[model samples]
Target: MLCYEELREAVDNGYIIGDTLNVVRKNGKVFDYALPGEPVRPWEIVTVESLIDIMTELSNYQ
Candidate 1:
């Protein structure tokens, strides 16, 4: 799993491109996430569950 710091590092290094994720917030907490190319509004109710898959995918590029 990718911890907060690791994910931040990835973003800072440009390993994860911009607009790759769409995050929605309610009351200062994450409510949902949209993958690349998904809608930006009418928020889809979904959970990220885990970042293991994303981390694995990003690893291939590294």
Candidate 2:
């Protein structure tokens, strides 16, 4: 998960809250985009199955 302050800063700096951002590896040799865009944080799981599961679970919570 992205740090609270990091998320805030990102948004304040023009990054959309739900925008799927890329996670660049520490070595700067690798990077992956977990989501598309709009309010999710970094390091958040973003696989198609995971997304479906999350949506289902969230819907249940609601």
TM per candidate: 0.32, 0.30
- lDDT tens per residue, model 2, 23-52: 433233222223345444565444432323
Error of 1 at 2 (Å): 17
Report lDDT (Cα) of residue 39, candidate 2. Answer: 42
Candidate 2 lands at a TM-score of 0.30
Give the Å error, residue 4, model 1: 13
Give the Å shift of residue 24 in candidate 1.
1.0
Q: Report the alpha-carbon TM-score of model 1 versus the true structure.
A: 0.32
Off by over 4 Å in 2: 17-44, 47-62
| Pairs of residues clashing in candidate 2 | 17-38, 17-39, 18-37, 18-38, 18-39, 19-37, 19-38, 20-36, 20-37
Report lDDT (CA) for all predictions: 0.51, 0.38
Q: By lDDT, who's the top model here?
A: 1
